[model samples]
Target: MVVVVGKEEVVVVNFGNSKAVLCRGGLAVPLSSDLKGERADEKGRCDDEAVVGRTINWNACHLPPLSTTSRSLGGEYRKQYIIMEPEVTVMKRTEQSDDFLIIATNSLWNVVGDKTACEVVKRYCVNGESGRLMSSDGSSTAAAASEAATALAVLAMAKGSRHNISIIVVQLK
Candidate 1:
């Protein structure tokens, strides 16, 4: 994860299934791509039909169930099964655009899509939730970040994610 608050733009680099997005106003400008690991490409486009056919053939002869492996960035069997690559993006940052940066693993994304996550982060920003994250006990920034992260995890679990969930919410001005 990388965010440089430059005078002109925001630079972002994300790896694997985790993502980093720039939310401007109520919209989102995604900075990373989800790597499902199994497929030859992300976005599930048919342009890669030829590639998909060959992958399926290879998997049939080697691994089965190519549906889930379409895009992943995990480590296990990455060389043989999935693609673990990172997506880097750069964008201009303005008062009206590039509001927040959302960096989290698939654990949170698998449960809630971009829109939902952006909304949650937006609310936190608008309501001064970051300031409240530390609470009255003189907790540190880590504590506040942890509190928001646990909230996201709990939400994901409630949304029916079977995997372990973790999140980091950064309130950027």
Candidate 2:
């Protein structure tokens, strides 16, 4: 997952199972689409007839041994189906509505929906709880982000995700 945070906007670029979500107006807004063969757009990108028709066994593409990602930065097997290109999304920063940003792997996303993840972060970040982020100090905010990330990872594990969970929480407001 790649996220570029500018002074006025934030750009998200992603491939494979990772995602970038923005919390706006107390709601979760997805910034990048998971590059899975199950998605119509992703499936249409592949020219292979077999991969296009079949469900790739596990998640989304051919080569179950390598990965289920339809799009990846590097992978030799089934190069025709697994493209290297990534999808990009750009959004203007709205201080009034935007709250925070969440970037996580499939391990977390497989069991947790975007809204649920956002709610979890909000619950900790806004309530002066372990993830309390609404502070003027930078260090406190950093601590909150860490706490929020840990909470998300724990929640994903509790929900029964077998994959490796990685999460990053960025407080915007």
Top candidate when judged by lDDT against the true structure: 2
User: What stretches of model 2 exceed 4 Å from their correct place?
Assistant: 45-47, 50-55, 59-66, 127-139
> How well does candidate 2 score on lDDT at residue 64?
42
Clash counts per candidate, in order, are 10, 0
How close is each model in CA RMSD to the real structure? 5.5, 3.7
Give residue 165's error in model 2 in angstroms.
0.5
- For residues 50-141, write the lDDT of model 1, one tens digit per residue: 44443344422222244344434445644444344446678777754455567787778877888887766554443453323342255554
Candidate 1 Cα lDDT to native = 0.58
For every model shown, what is its TM-score relative to the native structure? 0.63, 0.83
Residues 1-173 of candidate 2 have per-residue lDDT tens digits of: 78998879999988778999999888999998777666777666553567544445544355444456777876565565576778889999987678889999988887899999998888656543233474334457788788888899999989987677999999886
Off by over 4 Å in 1: 1-7, 37-77, 126-146
